[model samples]
Target chain A: MIEFDEVSYGYGGGPLLADVSLRLAAGSFHFLTGPSGAGKTTLLKLCYGELIASQGRVGLFGEDARSLGRDDIAMVRRRIGVVHQDCQFLDHLTVAENIGLPLTVSGRTATEEDLGELIHWVGLDGQRQSRPPELSGGERQRAALARAVVMSPDVILADEPTGNVDWDMSLRLLKLLVELNRMGKTVMIATHDLNLIRTAKQQVQARVLRIASHRVQLAGADL
Target chain B: MSRALAILQFLAGDAQADRVVPPTGFTARLTVFVSATMAFLTVFALALSLATGRLAENWSDALAQSATIRVSAPDGQVEDQVIAVMDVLATTPGVADARALTDDEQRALLEPWFGPDLPLDTLPVPRLIEVIETPEGFDAAGLRARLAGEAPGAVLDDHTRWREPLVRAADRLRTLGLVSILLIAATTGAMITLAANAALAANEQVIRVLRLVGARDAYIARAFVRRYTLRALAGALVGTLFGALAIWLMPEAEATGNFLTGLGFRGVEWLWPFTIPPLAALVAFMATRRAAFATLKERR
Candidate 1:
């Protein structure tokens, strides 16, 4: 579980978010939607230990984020998976190597069967031998998601994961996220697509949070 | 120190062996070429310093323990004065030996400065006597007083006036050689450090990708440390090989020209140049390891 109390974040010059408090309990699903430049990404960064709160406290599992050192933050990150919009990857490494990176970093041995299963699950089996740059848009996103969950994190955060894919690919990606949530993983996604959220509401009991007025708010029926 | 450990690990195949960043052929070539050039120059500096040291020691030791006395007495009285000087020297406690130079020896000694045809017997030039001293050393003042009473024309030369300058020059050359070695070491460290920094900057994207995949600082740094350490080892090996060859090509001590003599490693001293390769590798290891960790932390 993650909690934020009176969290105000600014870049030391101008405030991007002011006096916003939020909580993400275990096994819950959420969508963070907002207009452009509405601190959606900034809020997600705060959720992880990437940015320290300028005003209040952010707790991960139960410990304060600010109190954690570098190693501590790294340990916490292993339990909390993050998928960036750009889908960063090592161009020199093959898709299979990139997919197994999380396990490799944690010093966990990934057997042949486990890796094969993961590739089949992500629908990247055919492209496993190719480099990350050689993959298509949809393939890269799926690859990034595969890397994100390779550690089997308790919480998964995706920032615009389906931004570069087609409508059919977006729904396919959404189904994967839904399947992880069904497995008792806490999922928080930040996206501007309202239709996706409306479609997601039919599959799972997910709450929507909207960012406006430089603060976060729980959107009512309109979402 | 850290470099040796990294090479051990890399050769042992304990590294993560990730291929996130592609290798640059140009940087590898540059590193090898630069290291070789620096090593060649360092070898010459080392030779210059060592050779001058042996010269000063030999010159000082030979001159300080002996002297030459030229007795300028009347032509017919030369034999009487030589016998008198011998008696005075034998009675002195520290006079190890006193012998008059033979006529042929005197002509041979003057042959280099004066032509061999110069008539030594016809000239009124004084007869020469060679004196050798013991460890306790003969006192010049007391010997001079005894020679003045016994043989008025005898004058002693202890060889002190020129001995100290030769020794000081030799000592200074030895210091210069040692300083040159230090400079070479420092240059190697700085160049390797910059090369490591450049390698880090070039692989910024690889680092970001690795970090995203849950790589720790240690893991990322290991990849870089391994690559650079190997590069340094290869570069320095070639450099050291060429340096040793260049040193060996020099005219050895027993060569014809005395001036060109002694310009190389002394016996059993060839082992010192062997340390350069490992030292270069060690420098690369430290520099790359530091740069890798620093960049990783900065990314975090």
Candidate 2:
């Protein structure tokens, strides 16, 4: 339930994303496609209240994003799961610890069985105790996904979830996301990968939004 | 009171929360070393202040209830004036006791300056009478008037002029020692803050990861704060122990009864040094919390 109405963001030089208005309704899956430096990450950031809109209002969960205090932002973030492109992880933490981080930070405790099931679902059962630096790229992405969903958030915003993986690994990650969506969780993924988008269409109903000319437009069937 | 309980709750942290941030070696050691050094110095400052306070009180009490009389008359009349001063002191209502100082006693008082070989008989030094006062000291003005009437050459020296300056100097030294301890605490806080900032900077990626997972700034700050506080506590405990040992081993003041020799804790005062570690921990907790929150906000 994130809405951006006529939101414009920019660095000091000029506008990077201009007059972008979009609404992500509950129980929906989305794919954001654009060229490099096209503000895909910026849109995700605004949606999560990491970056406030410069010209227009960005609302998260029916509240204005700009007005949320730091603690409020943290609470809102607990309802939104974000998987970064680089699959950021604490290098010193084991894969299991990283996956359980969201729950830990929120003052919630995940039982061993639940965490074990999640790790097994991500196919990281064998690497449970392995640190982030020792994991493969695909393993890192899956670990990041596991961490993002550990809190059972209402919305999932993923930026280039499969960018660093091979086609098979990408499809496997997409399958996990599709499974998550089938369970009624809203998911929005930003990427430039067309093949992955085509593959995702076969598994689930997903709307494709393309960022071009500093604005977001609904992509046609040709994509 | 509620705030202190909240701090205690934070200190009793979850194992999972503490595991989020990786252990940093250099900053940890730096904080411990700074805390230890500052704590050691703080113990000395506390000792100095306490010792000076005792010295001031002792000097004030010893000088307050006593007065002296100097009989500066011609040689033939000196003995008569001394006898008259003694007789007048005997009738003084609040006078505890009064005795004329023997030549040997006068010589012993001046031995440090005049040397042991000086001939007291050949000197024109005034005859001195030591006066001890009762709990309710004698009225000096009344005694001076009586002495002038009966023995004009006898001068009442109540020792106020000499005592006041010594007490004031000791009091000032005590105040300066307290100020030094405060400055040291402030410096300890500053150094710990700098070290925390460096640790936070080095762990930027760790912070980013934690934030992405919905960790509040307070939660993140608690991780760092708890760590620094414990390190400071441990280091300060060791430092205080060594400092107390050093002070304990110093030569006993009973041998000299000199001010320098008495610059240490006495009786119940020995418990004072034990407070330093907890104080150091508190300083570290506040400093690290401030630094962590500031750094987190800045990065955001």
Candidate 3:
């Protein structure tokens, strides 16, 4: 769980995000939507302790984010899986190696059976030997999802998970997130796709937060 | 001890950890080349230091053991003065034995400068006496005073004036050689640090991915430290072999008869250069670790 209490952040020049208070309770699903160049990515980074709040407090797992060391932040990150818009991957690694990175880096060995099952669930079993650059946009997104959940993290944060995919592929990706949410994992997805959010709303009860004019607000039920 | 053991454990890392950082082509080659060159120089420095130490010890031992006395009397009185100088040396407390040199001995002493056939007896060459000192040698000042009174033509020359300066020079040269080795180590560390920083900067995306996936700083640092350390070790091994070969191929001291040109190892001294590779590896390990941690902290 993460809590931001009246947090205002600035990068030297001026405040990009101001006086934002939000709490992500256990097993809840939420969506963060904003225009490009807004503080969405910065806010997501704050949730994982990548950036400290310039004013007020940001709490991660009930601990002050500012008080944690890099190692402690890394430990906190192990429980919070992040999926970026670009689907970052070590391009030199095969899909299987990329997906199993979290376990490998944490000194835990991933059995072939477990990795195969996870890959197959993400529809990437046939591309296990293929590197990241050879994968299409949809395949890359699914692979990133598989990697995110390989460790069974407590919370999932996705920044534009369906930003580069088609309609059917976006739904496919959304279905995966919904399935993960049904299994009691807290989920936060940041996107500008209103149709995807509307589609997501029909399947699961996801609260929406919108960032505008340097502050966050709970969106009304206009959609 | 535990810290040392932990460092050893870090150095002996797992293969999975090493795969996190992609193998950088340029930095890898740069590190290997620098390490090999520095290690090659270090081998020579080590040889110079060890050789100078042996030279100093030899000179000090050979010169401290014995001395010579020269008698510059007229041709008719030179033989009698030589005998009188021998008698005075025999009664000295720290002198073990003394003997007047024969004509043949005098000729052999001058054989290098003059030809072997030089007529030593024809010239008015001063008569000489050899003095061997006991462990507790006689004071030169006291012996000089005795020689002056007993045989006015006799001059006691213990070789202290020339020997002390030569010994001091040798000691200084040995110290300079040791300082050169230390500077080589320092330069190796500096080069490795620069190379590691370059690699870290180039692998920014790799670091970002690893950190995003919950890899700790130490885990990421181990990948770099291990790579550089192993590369340095391998390169230094090759350098040391070449250096040893070069030393072995030099002219032998007996053949050259010049101590300065004889900069190679001797007998068990050859084992000394074998340590350079491991030392280079240690320097690489420390340099890479420091740079990696510093970069990680900066990124954070």
Candidate 4:
């Protein structure tokens, strides 16, 4: 769970996110919608303790994010999976290796069968042996998603998971996220794509929060 | 103790952990080459230090228990003064033996400078007496007084003034060699740190990716540290082997006691060079660990 009470963040010019208060409860799905440069990714970063709030407080797992040590933050991160828009992967690693990275880094081993199952689930079985540079945009995104969830984290924060993929691939990714939600894992996605939000709304009980004018507000049933 | 065990465990390493960072050819080569060069120099430094230490010890011990006496008198009275000096030495409590060097012995001592054909009878060369002392040596002051009373032309040369400076020089040489080794180790550390920094910078994306997946700074640092340490170890091992082989192949020391001929390991001293590789690895481990953590903290 993540809680930001009156949290504000800025990069010295002016406030990017100001006077924001929100709570992500356990087993909940959230879609953060905002125009470009509206602090959607920044909010996600604050939730994961990647950036300390410049004012007020951001709490992760009931602990103050600002007060937690680097090691403590890393441990907290093990419970939260993040999928970047660009699908960051070690470019030299094979798809299977990249997907198994979360478990490996956490000092755990994933059996070949389990990793293979996850790879197949991500529709990356054919590209398992290919390096990140050799993969298509959709393949990279799915690989990134597989890597994020290999540890079976309690929360998944995805930023523009479908930005580089086609519509069919986007739906496939959304279905995977929905399946994860059905298994009781909390999911939060930040994107400007309204159709994805509408599609996710019908399949799962996801709340829509839109960032505007440097504040997060819950969008009404208009969508 | 637990910390040491933790370091050992870290050194034992994980195959999976090592695969996280892609192999960097340039930094890898830089570390290995620097380690090898430094380690090669270290072997020589170690050899020089050990050889100088032995030389100092040999000079101190050999000179401490022996001395010399020179009799310079009128040609007719030289034999009498030598006889008196010998008698005085015989009565000394700790004088093990005293013998006047024959004319042939004196000629042989000066053979290198004056040539073997020098006319000893014509040149008025002073007579020399070699004095060997017991473990508890005779007091030079007391023996000097006795010789002055009996033989005015006789001078006691206890060899202190000559031996002290030589022994001191050898000891200082040994210390200098040791200091060189320390400096070499420090230089190796600095070079490895620079290489590690470059590697860390080059692998910034890898670090970001690792951090995103919940890898602690220590986990990431270990990946780099283990690689650099192993490279340094392997390079140093090869360098040390080559260094030791070069030393072994040098010409053996002759009876002339030339320092250059003796500049090598003897017996168990050969084991000293073997320690360089592990020491290089330790230096690499510490340097890489520090750089990795610093870079990670900066990124954070």
TM-score of each: 0.91, 0.95, 0.97, 0.96
- Candidate numbers sorted by lDDT from highest down: 4, 2, 3, 1
Scored by TM against the true chain B, the candidates give 0.85, 0.91, 0.95, 0.94
lDDT tens digits by residue: candidate 1, B1-300: 899896565766543454545685666666666566666666666677777877777777788789887798988898899999998888998889889998889889889999888798789878899999997888898988999999999888887777787788788988998898788767866776677678778888777766655666787787777777777778777777888798888665676577667778888768767777777777777877877777777866
User: Among all windows of ten consecutive residues in candidate 2 chain A, which has the lowest summed lDDT?
Assistant: A105-114
Instruction: Give all candidates' CA lDDT scores.
Output: 0.82, 0.92, 0.90, 0.92
Candidate 4 contains a number of clashing pairs equal to 0
Q: On TM-score, who's better, 1 or 3?
A: 3
- Given candidate 4, what's the lDDT at residue B174? 98
- lDDT string, candidate 3, B1-300, tens digits: 999998777667787777878989998998899888887887888888888888888888877878899899877888787778878877889888888888898888899999899887789788888888898888999989988988899887888899888889888988999999899889989998999999999999999999999999999998999999999998899888888998888887778886655588878888888889999999999999999999999976
TM-score of chain A of each: 0.97, 0.98, 0.98, 0.98
Q: After TM-score superposition, what is the CA distance of residue A214 in candidate 1 from its true location, in Å?
A: 2.2
- Greater-DockQ candidate between 1 and 4: 4
Q: What number of clashing residue pairs does each candidate have, in the order they appear?
A: 0, 0, 0, 0
TM-score of 4: 0.96
By TM-score, who's the top model here?
3
| Model 3 agreement with the true structure over A4-51: per-residue lDDT tens digits | 999999998899999999999988999999899889999999998889
Against the true structure, whose DockQ is highest? Answer: 2
Worst 10 residues of 4 chain A by lDDT: A105-114
Candidate 1 residues lying further than 4 Å off, grouped into runs, are B1-7, B70-81, B124-128, B140-155
DockQ computed for model 3 against the true two-chain complex using alpha carbons:
0.84
Q: After superposition, how far is residue B128 of candidate 2 from its true place, in Å?
A: 1.7
Colliding pairs, model 4 = none
- Model 3 misplacement above 4 A: B1-12, B260-262
True contacts kept of 1: 0.52
